[model samples]
Target: MAARALKLKPPPARLWISEWPRGAINAARLAGARRRLREVPRGDGRPVLVLPGLFNSDRSNFALRGYLNRLGYRAFPWVLGRNLGARTIGVEGERLFARIAAVAAETGAPVTLIGVSLGGIMARLAAHRRPDLVREVITVSSPFAGDPRATNVWRAFEWLTGERIDDPRVAALREEIARPLPVPATAIWSASDGLVNGRACRIGGERAIEVVSSHVGVQLNPDVLVVIAKVLNGQNADHD
Candidate 1:
């Protein structure tokens, strides 16, 4: 049977310029509301590994990792440096699987993966291939369920990864990542996202959480943080 491909359009250009300002506002809100985060449920000390978005490095996720750490989870950085699509992680994401395996081995348990933007897509890929090493996956603003061209950053992705959106390998990888994960998965998306289409971020038959955040700053949004904390604390099953 032929593979299923969903073709969704990217977010509007008018929303693109609002990304930075909205992100800044969300960052400020997070800073002021740090105390409220302490009120959220604590984690069970599970290992959680975070992956950065395209053109981003561990630094981009520093705030998120710190928040998870404060909540009692052992949050670790991807440590593979900046994300440049297949160039940094490989076409089959072997490095990402190795990283997940290493964390699982060190912690003596499966690690939950939290990925932002492009990193979320990579997280899903790793979970699909190495479910034994992953406890669960949480994606923020990742467009793993539709046409790669459905993102505003597709051109940038092509330039950085040196792979065309129409490449057969890309198509195959998309199919694999979009498949139902062996382990539990959750998608945190925003219809107001300024990069990828929000519909593409959500997959069928998985828990989906909607937030009013921009694609550029969804990772740092305090609401997103709370939702993630709840999911990790096993308190977000209502969304299922």
Candidate 2:
């Protein structure tokens, strides 16, 4: 990578080179929703926990959360206020776990986490720490693999957070995802995602659905909502 790239400044117009011919193939699959998407049964018993991206932006997930509710699932938000980078994830786990516990008590069931971007990353940690409470995890546009440099905005994100992009924990996270989760996991990404390298969105040998959505728009995009519904429904059926 160039020193200029490391500075986290704009490259003006760096047309990112696509590495594979899969983008076209992915688009075609998403275009035929009937052919590509299966009829998913409504959930059986678990409630869903929705995590918004870096900015609290829980409101962004309103559409998907509401959809989950309509499908007979109880859905809740992080409720830690806005996602202000106020606390490192390691620090937030206790609170996140508490929220999970509280939600589980309220609904009388285990929970599924649907996370967007950084929230997705948090969901991974939650699932790793508390499998008893988390039945499944589904993320949209979250980069689970090693490096964030693949995404042009990563440097800027680090700068904004005042943290090192290559923090030792970063490497550990990559290694961790290589291990299988106790429960099922699904990742959703898009070729047009201007922020994340869509390829990095894959997690735990699970299905990675390709959706057409802006990096900032996944929470509200109808296509993303549909995929979330399918995964949540599928997970519920597994127990039945």
Candidate 3:
């Protein structure tokens, strides 16, 4: 059978307008952290490593890491400073590989990788290159299944990474990054996302899940958090 072609259209302009309100609501999530904590299942203290999106640093995932910690998981930040795309993935992804190995060694078990947006793409790549160190992979709002230009942030990504969207190297890397992960993987996407086309985020298969959230708010969206908790606790038998 022939491979399916990717449809690459940017999301409607109106969707972008919802971002502001959604972000504001997500910011308010901190106020209910204690309450939200009771709603999700706890983990077995397995290590979880979180990666931030482009232009973001470990600080961007503070809330997420904190939440995971409260759930009895040993969550850690990437500690790689701001995400700058190709630079961090260079040397055949040695930097990321080393980090995963370190985390696995520290936990005495493979680590679960939870990435947000661009970070999700990196997580998938890490899992592909070193499945032995990865327990599972979960991506939020990552457009790994479609053309790189299928998102509103493509230009910003180019600006931050210093790589042209059409550059051969960038294209090749995207193709490699889009390959199916060797470890179990889940793609959590939001239909109301403004930065990227939601359709482009689907990984195609039983592992794809859809929620209602904004691109910037997905990290804090209550529904998204619940899903993450479920996946981490190995309670999502439907997807697995």
Candidate 4:
């Protein structure tokens, strides 16, 4: 019989108190954007699709997409309005898949997918379903490898998605989602994440980079951006 997946305890409530300060730090990243922009390797104008987390929309990833655009990559948003977990994934996932396919077709090159939090999970599923359309994937603070309920936001996910965490359908889908992607994938996690359990954010046999930031701040954190640039440029030998 297959072994049961281990479930980690959610992060402490006290740690969540640090989330506000982390948001401020991420906001301040804009001040040094130009400096950091020059520090990272420029992209080859390859197509990149950015997906937002749960309860977020394309607008949430505007800053990150803007940064990618400035770095010479053709970054595009998911275009599908706000993410509503299973509601989005169940009904609109085909649309998301079609979007990636369209971008890959237009560019005549496999698209790189960058997903934040729940968005990352969607990215992985997209890659798994259509690896031919994907070049590489980078997940920001996403707990795709472990139990979905391992994060503090699990309750919210259930409430918003209207799917119970332990429901048979959710359980079966979660099992599938936890599988490794067929393409080159990187998981960028934080040690100080306030919403998700960092320990649950790992996939076996893939590159995992640790950054110091909050769950929400990973998108704007300078170090995280640097790591992303390196991964995209194929400059990070460790990930290769």
Among all candidates shown, the one with the greatest lDDT: 1
Q: Between prediction 3 and prediction 4, which has the larger lDDT?
A: 4
Per-residue lDDT tens digits for candidate 2, residues 198-236, read 767774357778876657555655566666776775643
**Cα misplacement distance, residue 196 of candidate 4 (Å):** 0.5
Candidate 4 wrong stretches, greater than 4 Å: 1-4, 237-240
> What is the descending TM-score order?
1, 4, 3, 2
Record all residue pairs in model 3 with backbone atoms less than 3 Å apart, i.e. clashing.
Answer: none
lDDT of 2 at 166: 72
Runs in model 2 lying further than 4 Å from the true structure = 1-41, 85-92, 235-240
Question: Model 4 over residues 111-175: C-alpha lDDT tens digits?
Answer: 99999998998898888788999999999998887776678888899888787879887676566
Please give, for residues 1-240, the per-residue lDDT of candidate 3 as tens digits. Answer: 222326787777888877888887887874676675567677799999999998999988888888889889999998888999868756467888899899999889999999999999899888878889999999999988788767888989988888786878766667777777778888898777888888877656538888878888678776777778888877762322
Model 1, runs deviating above 4 Å: 1-3, 237-240
Clashes (backbone N, CA, C under 3 Å), per candidate, total 0, 1, 0, 0
List TM-scores for all candidates, in order. 0.96, 0.75, 0.92, 0.93
Best by TM-score: 1
lDDT of 1 by residue, 1-240 (tens): 333657788889998889999989988899888787787888889999999998899999999999999889999999999999888897689888888889999999999999999999999999988888899999999998889788888999989878887888888888888888889999999889998899999877899998889887777888888889998988853332
Q: Rate the local accuracy (lDDT) of all candidates.
A: 0.88, 0.66, 0.82, 0.82
